[model samples]
Target: NLEYQGAFLYGEITANYDVRNHLFEDIKLRYDDIYKGHTLELGNYKYMDDGAREWDISFKKDKGYIITGSKNYVIKENVPLGSRVELLYLGIIIDIQNATNGVVEFKNDEIKEDRNYQLKIYTPDGKILIKDISTTSNYNQQNKGEVEYDINIREDHESKRNKIDSKVYYGLTDHLTLGMGYLREPELINDEYEYLDKGRLEAVYSNYIYSLPYTFRVGGDKVFNEFEYKVNEKNTKDDYSYDFLGQIDIKKVRLRLEHESKGEFYEDKYKTKFYVRYTPIKALDLEYEREEATKRDGIYGIDYKEKINKYSIEYSKAYKDLLLTGEYEYHTEDKGKYSFNTYYTGLRTATLKLENTWKNDGKDYEVAFSIFSNGNRLFDYNLEARYTEQEKDKFTFRFSTNYNNWFDYEMFVDKKGNQEHKFGIDHITDLRNPTAKIKNMDSSPLKVITFVDKNDNDIYDEGEELIKNVEVQIGEQKINTNENGEAMFYGVPNYVTYDLEPKIKKPNFLLGNNKVQVQGKNTATIVAHIPVKPMLTLTGFINVEDILELNSIDKMRLYEELLVTVKDTNGKVIDRAIPDEQGIFEISGLLPKKYLIEVVYMGIDHQIDGINDEIVKLTYVDVRHVS
Candidate 1:
């Protein structure tokens, strides 16, 4: 298609493929962003392997496979020799006299997104990880091509991830730490020791590597991993895995020592698996992964995954405008493989996306190339392009067009073999745009006045000139350019700051560095233009253990909200709470710092300022015990 009245046929098909022989003719479309938010994709697929009956656990005459582990590239600068250490480096239950509070010893990993009003409170506090884990299995074998009748094949299975976890972390000292993880599934092990599943306590210790070029340490793991089959009679829930990995780092190299063991009941499984990656520079990375399940029961059929995942390399540039990324992943598992009984499992999604932008003639144009592949076939190539003109102060012309499979070259013998190809593209735009959407009060000066001290004096002493071009913000809303040092922050949520981190990046900046999503509603900005400290206070009645009901806060500072809620029978809140012009709060609520006040406030607590009602509770919760 050609340009018809300036609106060129943007969505073009540049690929050549026999559409008449495929399920989908031409796939074409363009979207605003690739990582579309608010989406949960669910899909299913199936596969059947005919070489099942020939399942032999003999490693002698089998395929030549390398059962070694791999690692991902990581910056390898071991800091302060001993300071650069993981939890396992400390040492097992070793502590000297006194000097305890010195070394904080805990491994923490936590991701919490409270859907309770979409409160994505992703706090990275140490020592919290693993939300939910689930495991299941089922299997049955049958004759291949026989009219057999009375012939029978063993059928049995059971798998589960037990709850109860022993976080028991013994802080040996300020520089050393030790901890363990224990799990057990008792109720499911009924009369069969084979089905008795339990995870042994996992422990680790990290110690400061005194006097070394880089942080160097060694640690080990002792896990009496349970099994699914006690005597190979189809262990119901008794199947577990355990492995030990030792690590050492100096200069820019990282080494890993792995020694694992699988009970003899399970065959063909590896006894140990390990690998490590070391980065010579921040821009380069390397990795490898390996696994072995020796005499592993229920792994091949309906037990746990007894197969191995090996030889995968993945590299990525952490900081780069145009990043080069590639990875090779290969795995073989029979547990969930498709079969005649239940043939639905494993959903793998792969897509190749290519995007590039060019600036010339004071205008910017971006072209996106993508290919979605599945089942060893190229489903479609979405080749899209967009152009924009930002020569004005308020508006720009955004013109986008894409080729529907236009770049597709299918069944083409490309020096190697015959490959299939398909293509498509899409885009849309608003010719007219506005810089500021002033609403609420009729034309109030959305002034963003930030006071910056040119002298770099900590105090805003008199005679200190205010810095120009500095930013002022209000809940992620901001504007710039003015003489009075104030920019428009219209429609901004009251709690303003010296800098309003953008909810969006400038198109020019985005074009160069792919794009960045900066999220957060802050009332904290750095500036000398405004010499006002947010009045913080506690106006409501707060009590111990009460998860502060943040949703009830008005245009008040969090500190003020904490003051209102005072001494009350556990779980009581304060009456109406509000804040003064200054971010200050009146602590009407009673309670020592001992009994944590579900302080909805931050700063004196945490510096999270937002109106989203995502409560910033105390650092830790007080748990009750019952006999």
Candidate 2:
């Protein structure tokens, strides 16, 4: 039987034999991170149960196969690095601890350190490789507080040359390190001017200017640059170059700068770099970079958005259903010459975006389209619609309107027998479960047009009329603002309010300042403004003799949302209300409680002192709602 706890596995066993068994295996599966790193699997699994035994099992897992005589594993120092062990615990046969079989081994069997005095070499895979002095080496411990030497040699033959060069550093104190090196035999042309030798000395400190999210890092790389160029086989001019980079993170944004100078004396060329970024707000980001005429240059980009909120206009672009963005980018050579061609004064890059939606229940529809232009002069557009319903006698509505620079197309459908005759354009047909078919027009990358019902007789009634701008508002409460500057509410008990206000200012045509009391859902339409007129007025508020507005009512009806709060003294909220479609709300399942009634109507709210449902409150009556 075996048991598991935390990150360890425990097991037990029992067997019988009294000196009658010969060569009986006594193995206790012992897994103690047997091996870790490159030469081993995540951890090694050894089958410690060498021969047949009373009970045994092996698993290549967290509890890698190990068998020991005791419950705990042997200490790393006690276990010989290359030897395998198998043991017995209590009365159980554990596992197998296979001997090392696939690698180089020495007579003493202690992981051979570098075979020779070599520090780096190459494997058959042709990849340059490096190995550090093992922790077991006295040389490593002697140089403990020093930068370990890292050497590199050719993948061809490492033992032949001292291409094995590395910088070794030794620490003398907490802030200072004394270091020196002669790693490479710098080649000399004609032996006139050469690198000869190189060395370094440095100091470091902490606990400087402090900030929670920002940090400052300062360091320098000093490379002795020396070399002479041979012209016509004779020593001529010399070449030297040095460089350094400073990077810091200030408040989450990154700041980086690099400075480099090449060539000796008067011919040296120096280049300086600067970059900064700030994200002051979550939704907006700003950046800037400049490398001057010495090479790099560019005024980066800043972007933001404001599309989903009410009373807002979108400043965006689109291409074939994909939305694009805008930004300013300057250039000075890097991303390839002509990356920012100075030859063109009018050509600019542009991105596009298109909106898409799916339709299945299929009756409701809405459309919005726009085209933004830059010097790139690219084109893009997309339209989407969706509708779903669960009822049959559905008088669903769908209408089209044009708001862009595209060709126009018209459509109409007639049903006969079991087939439908769709007019004007091509229709791709699709059908789904429980008997439903959808016929749609083909989409294109070119021009597009929208068709609006002309005579208001959605039947595609022929020869009736074809008015281009015939005030196409769809609904039964159809209307046209008369010469008297207004259209009367018809079919609809109350005049309709347009969600968007007008933009023009002259010859004002507006929603009537009147309220109609009727119960039930009703659709109303009214003449917004005359052709070429600018009227921006809304009319939907009740009032009381120039002093206050209509705040409370008894048996009247309303269509908008209301926040009804029932409360008592000490500002304690007792209950609240949310009305439904018919402007009728009966908050039931309520236990008897004291409450002050506050009614939210139109844009104003009204409350009154406690009044029992047993008494009828008069219309438009004002009560202290409580003191």
Candidate 3:
């Protein structure tokens, strides 16, 4: 069997298919908000909301309308000429009319006051409209003028039988409601087939009497079993019944009492039931119920009375990952019988379950054990294990075993106890595109770029280079700039401020804006400027006299004691360097400005003015007397 349910623009649709039985079981279309307090339904639909009795047999191709409201309101609608209209109260067809001059109207007098009425319209275009009249009204002062109704219809295809049931209720006063119902069905009576009609009249009262909530319903039923063959015999039977329910609440405990007297149609039985429930805390619940019933029965025309009493208690408690539940029932009739049951589970629905699921890793594991019994003997037990893995492909493996009569404790053990074992594996290559994509309309995209600012200006110049592979932290997300020096974040909430910080630290480079505040608007773009610091290196050689008189070690130490210092225009010492045996000296980390380079050797100072040249070469001469 396969079933599917979906919603369209206006309403909902449901379809079912039974491969083993009827291939196309049924399909239904329902629209609840079609018009003002109206419902439209087509195909196989239930006549009653509670799925009790009334049902459309086969496929109802023509759509119909269901209207609910009270009699004080009038219904006026424009439709095709000569359209058929029906008014149903409870479940009974009360009136039928036809449209004239492209319009139809239902007056208030034609409608009974304080009664729920339904108007079903069948247009010429195979469309049906139903309007509910009574439920749309506002009755704030008193409920005395309100009315309700229930209707159900059932059809049996094999027997070609149809059953109709309907009930109408009216609030006579603030606390009392009067109702009447009718039911008709085909039955086999005394070797003769006939249609039995049942009618009932009931009154219900619900209110707080002396600060105690109570409700009572009294009704009488009359059955008419008119037979064609037995016309002379009496065919009418009547019975009366009543039910009373009361409840009292005291702090965390609640007590309830119910008494029911069933008529002859229900075996002429009387039952009294009591229930108590207590909850001292939120995690625990305790409940108990007792019922006593007396029934009159006749065996071979010997009338006798039988009495039965039943008692049951239920307890439930939940703690962290585990839940415990237990129930016990005792019944006293011909032979006393008792049963006890208990259940425990880590998961709310599973009897005994263990599972580990990792959605990101695409792996899931589950093991479960379940058992069912009738308190006296074990019925069945099931053990199952399932593993699922979903990465590039999806794979699932399942193993299960079911054993019947697992613990019967019989004299002769049945080795081949009723058992079923199943093992299956499924592999799916593609689990993608399983659902439709939805676009977020409330968010925007934000793009951040980082670039080199060579002109000392905050703006990015045309020829300026763009920095790549730089990390930019926006909000809580860190993204690396692509080759285009752009980091994009899509679907960012609008009208929010995010702090942008660059994660690059260079020795001679200063970021124009270390921290930037960017607002996420529609398609926003921001740039982080980094200014490259000016740095120059100065290199020169030294000229020494009588170089041949010294050895290589002496020559190497000739400039070892010679120190060179560089100062900016402000006379601040920027850097210092010493010459090697080759008489080559280099000074680095100088700004793009005029600097003074001074060399001190043998207490003699040689000064050279170095401009903004990337490589400054100079020769220092040692004009000292022979020592």
Candidate 4:
């Protein structure tokens, strides 16, 4: 493409080829010179052996370099005896200067980002020595929106048939979504079929009304079935369906309502449901819901008219971090064997559910069980369990299972980014052949790394140690580092912001950035770094002359005690120190900053007409006296 501005051009070229055997490679090159500084990018993707894959991307601009492939660096420092200096990466301490005496030596294997750092020197007893310093930058992975498609395959041995379902969804905007779905066969497992037996195009719009949320959805669907003996055009059918939903959420109350109408192959049905929830206090919540459904069945077989009404009530309470909920439901249905007639058969059913949720560390866990029975038959029951852990950096991990032999496991790599890779194993209804599944995931999974910045440089040094037991969170999933200081999250979604934060914070450590925007299923990695802060001890004196006494011979000790105030550069008073018996006062553990010190004096009226103050720059320990 050519642009009129300076007659510049911009274009991209992509190529794919098989290197050898089962090995394949893809290359993309982009060029643009519309601005003062021309730009070029070379991206290479390779499918490695044993199903491994990797990507290499390079970008170039103008005369100076923006990013190079990789580099190594080192750091060396002299330290006092009994000083504890540690290098931290991703908030985990990787190296510490444990020597009681001698020069302190530290270095990193790489250069990462550019920023300021707080370097802490601590005493052997864990008291702080010197704390503040400046650092640089390290590498950060950029996340972008991604699109994904999923296909499900199932086979039934009893029926000798197979099923395949494909679905895709993409967001046109934050509130508008579009989707498509297709289901093949009458549970047909064979590949001999050429046509998709059923397909649908769908769209949904969601918006908010102050504290209330609402959504509208509409979709068009079509299905075709051919008799074994003959195929006819009339066998195909198409229809439209829609749904409306609304909800209101407040601190102590919530309400939700939904209505949906559908057109099926044999009949049309409509259903409506509404819920009301109230929280009378912090620890307790009450809720009620009602559902109504009317369906006309038997269009092709034994016909019947059915109407169902259901009502449920629930109570929930919080016991510290644990939450428990119990619910009871009553359902009644009327059915006319042939049509809406005078003689109707009525059925009543009841169900009960109990759920509990709690948290350990920064992760959330939940368990729910339900019992349902119609009349006096054997009761049907199911139990569910879910566990989730999220880090301060937005890395997340989730696990769920049900009594029906169904289970789901998911790991999110970068919760702070717009895109994420998701790895999952889902819905194993048949134990004989568990369906291992992957969604919103490419051939490669997303990576989240934690390391220590030993040199106080923003760059990531090769030898810089990786820290273990550190929690990394992507969105709502959390995982802790193993012995090697690494945690991997899978099944990340695209086109959304996944903020990452550490669940646990170490003392004297400060975080850099807590989140990143990740793009879809494409492999992405985010590194969260926390640097230690430097400490200082500030000593000062407050001297009062008591000038009104004039002839007082002991001027030096005229007023042995006085009050002094310390304010930061922003004029915010952070600390106050008063001299002890020796007229000397000291404050420790203070970070480097400019401070305003003042000597306060008062008369019998407790009012000050004039006072002297001093401003000093403090990085390390220093003595400042005021009168």
Candidate 5:
């Protein structure tokens, strides 16, 4: 018998001896984790059982495999990674695992002598290289010939596959852009390192930010072509897909339309959608959508077509930090007596969502719950909570269930200040079957520390002070340090990367680095430093002698109310101050850098008197005396 719990499998075997004077030898069974690309061998002790014999099976996975018994495995070389291998005895799956490191290992003694043990390795015949398109950053606003490109590189965790993607955007005009993109992946078959390629071309016109703005886009993608290795000829049709999108926005209303067609030459499918939204008030929104789909299937000159239509309406309201939304949709299909689909019947669904957020004691909490009900059956129910303080130092929880068949819960908590804290076992179960329960647990931590760099060095010295109450951020959660100047984030998911940054609130203090990238699974600690520099004071006064020499009444009178402004080398305003009754003004907290000091009086703006030419350098001592 075989049982499944999430991504793991459990199997049991039993045998009985019919004779009282019979003696049995050692019996063994093997099982493997096909998803993780690993295998295991287990053996039972020598025994003679009159009734039945049983063995408890278990597995613990890691980078390497370990077996319970000493049995040598014969490995088949050059099998290739990602190839599915199956171990069969008497035409039944005794064990199955994927090849790792381009080889499959198995022992022949695990199978019965009466049956033939056969191993088979199968490879994919066809695969889709790219199914979605995405871009990066904002469009270029330059007049012409300006180009912006986004590149993405990805490699599988097992290092068996790689993907290289690139997208380019050219500014043909102020409101138009010409775009192209390409994606590459290795072919799934054959021995050589041949790659498959897909490309797209598009023309986009968007002026949505103006008073009367609209947008239109037209694009097409070239599909991948299949090849037949046996005939040594490329076997494919002239396949392609096209898409069109248009949107218009008026004061309180918006309209959008979209259409897409795929497989123009064979097995064609077309879809179209229309949407309208109206928002007459700041708290209320209403929307309506209509979608239609048509599919064609043809083989050996015999063709069949099918059509489906769907309509939906949605209403949402927002009050303070709480949002509520409800949607209802209906679906119908064109049917005939000889049709592949059922006769035209209406199917209805209704979904409701409620979300709320609040803050308490410098911590933020959020709760969102949504449910979808089709006819009288509940389809999905999802509830998520983030950073909700349970007692003192724990948060981040989620709960989801669907059709009463599946349930999932996730939570994470820290144990004191230790970074290596495991979450309590989460019971993912099928409610209809009480015996099926999967318990998943994990423990990992990410800690960030802030310290004062006293000697202006990049390294953290022993005598450097640990600054308390420094803010650190992982994702959107902002955490402050404890008394020890350390902040820890618990329940971080595995196999992901996070960008860590420090939120400094003090001026004239610079961080050593702006952002740091951290990977999950391993305990990560980042040390950050803030170096504070000394400030220079610029003090000056309107020269009485120059005012008297001018002799003009307007010139001398203007000296009484003089304005002084200081700007850095980048022309950013640093400080502004007006002289007191004595015509003496002072600006402090200015860094020791080049600056431009401007003196304005009597509708005239001119450079300060003490500045050399148009710039002033303040390094040591205060810069004084100016008219």
Candidate 6:
């Protein structure tokens, strides 16, 4: 039994019984997860190397004959000692042993005759080395100017007769091929062995014909029988066959047609088939097929005919996390039959299906369900359920089955009657480390330098001081300058533009460059000039005097309310200060330039040198006669 659990995974189990020996042969189990690139297989499976190699030993199927220098097949190469060595056939591990002294050996008794095998050597570096152990060659399609041939010989033990078959094909052109085949078989007739020889010539052409892709094959065969010549004095018979297949694809519609005819000595048969598939919309598809066959019997002078017609439609739609599909098929054969199937899938991992099939002899109804999990903290599993009902005439039968396989189990059997079962558990965890160092080969470094442009030049000078601990922002990364006044940003992608800004917030300092373009693998450089300004402070004293007509309280208030103002050369008030009763005042944060100081009460101005940091002294006299 084979079960396809969808496109991701599938399972198959097969067992054989030998009636003559009254014994049960080995049972095979195989499961494949295409999505994960995993396979588990058991029972009698053949192993072939993923690569190609030459065999050191040969085995013949007749009497299990082993042809080798010794009874054991030994492999000695660059293989490391203690490495695991596995003998496999058709991708199934048959025997496993550890290598000793860089050599691995298998006894002849464990090998089968006339079978292709492979040796899988597990290297120390977690690599598998595949070696072929058979003489089979790989087959590839014939290319232009290429020739391919195959020969086979078979013996009939009961009749003591041998048959030989050979075929050869040559590529006449890229799209055309010519082939020839010959078969010679022995027949036991009247206690004598007679041979019948058959020869055939064929040609195949595949190319576009009138804008439609097509393939056509024409062949003729002749047979020569020694026994027939002895009985009827005529031994040669000729026959011919031809077939044509063509397909056209236009937009969402596909049409295919095939016609074939075979001529024989007693009868001639012809068949033609036509098929079309159309998708009117993305979620709907329609298909139809018609086939007709006719046979003419030369001896009986009778004609027989048969025809088949098929029609099918499929519709599928998806709504968020759920998918629904419906399909119906009708066939015009065997008294006519039709089937309808529906499927519902959720979360892309679980599916439910219902099917109803009607035939002239019986009706079958079935329901199937399956679910798959990719594996988590617990374990991965595949579960399936099926129920079937059949009705024939007045009788009805029902059957139901279920399968739950945890993890994955694959079994294999060898020709030596040895069996091995392998169980696997899949667990996926996010093993990502945030601190892991991943290097980007395409990225380049960015160097940013910050300095005080003392000479007012855009370039950095030797005597100029480099500004240390200056933060620089490049793209989304921020780096601080070292003692060398260099901030380096690593892993900057090449050929991209980024904003390079020196985040300097110091008073009286300015930045020069704010953008940099990185290119190739070269390091990008950004120069930021943080020029400083010479700031100065000025101090002064303001004195106010009033007549003795008022009291001491009024005299103190007049002095305390006095104000002093400092202005630039253009008479724009740059700063102001209020003096205390002691008449002392000061002004700061002025650039190195000339400024004027004035007393607001007296309305008098005085010049003070800002560049030299001179203090001002002002005297204000209030002139009022006791009013």
In the range 100-158, model 3's lDDT, one tens digit per residue, is 43346766222422245677766433346676655322211125866554555667443
For candidate 5, which ten residues in a row score worst on lDDT?
336-345
Superposed model 1: Cα runs more than 4 Å off? 1-170, 182-199, 208-242, 264-270, 276-282, 286-293, 296-320, 326-627
Better of 3 and 6 by TM-score: 3
Report the C-alpha lDDT of model 5 over 1-627, residue by residue, as the tens digit.
111121112321222222334644333333334233233434333323442333322232222212334213332422322344555333333334444433456553332111234555443211111111111112323346766555555443222455667777778987898988887766544554445677989988878666866878899987475544444343333557899988787988878888988874545577788877677865234555667666564665554555455443444333432333443344554211110101111223322333433334224444443332322211222222223445433323222222232332222233343232222322333333446231211213556667765554545678766766667786567888877778766534333577777776656455654555665432332233433334557887766555244454644455555667888888888998876656678898865567888876534443334333247777544555555
Highest TM-score against the true fold, candidate:
3
lDDT of 6 by residue, 88-118 (tens): 5444343455554334666622253224567
Report the C-alpha lDDT of model 2 over 101-137, residue by residue, as the tens digit.
2112112111121111112222111222232222221
What's the lDDT for residue 343 in model 1? 10
Q: Residue 38 lDDT in model 6? A: 32
Q: Which model, 2 or 5, shows the larger TM-score?
A: 5
**TM-score list, all predictions:** 0.27, 0.22, 0.38, 0.29, 0.33, 0.36
lDDT over C-alpha atoms for residue 380 of model 3 = 21
Question: lDDT of all the models against the reference?
Answer: 0.29, 0.28, 0.50, 0.44, 0.49, 0.50
Ranking by TM-score: 3, 6, 5, 4, 1, 2
Segments of candidate 5 deviating more than 4 angstroms: 1-149, 156-159, 187-194, 208-211, 223-234, 264-266, 280-285, 298-305, 320-323, 332-627
Off by over 4 Å in 6: 1-143, 146-169, 182-197, 209-211, 224-240, 244-257, 264-266, 279-285, 297-300, 314-326, 335-362, 372-384, 391-627
Candidate 1 overall Cα lDDT vs. reference?
A: 0.29
Tens digit per residue, CA lDDT, model 1, 16-107: 12335332212211111112111111111111222111111100111111122231111111011011122110111111011111112221
Query: Relative to the unseen true structure, what is the C-alpha lDDT of residue 227 in candidate 5, on a scale of 0 to 100?
Result: 49
Better of 2 and 3 by lDDT: 3
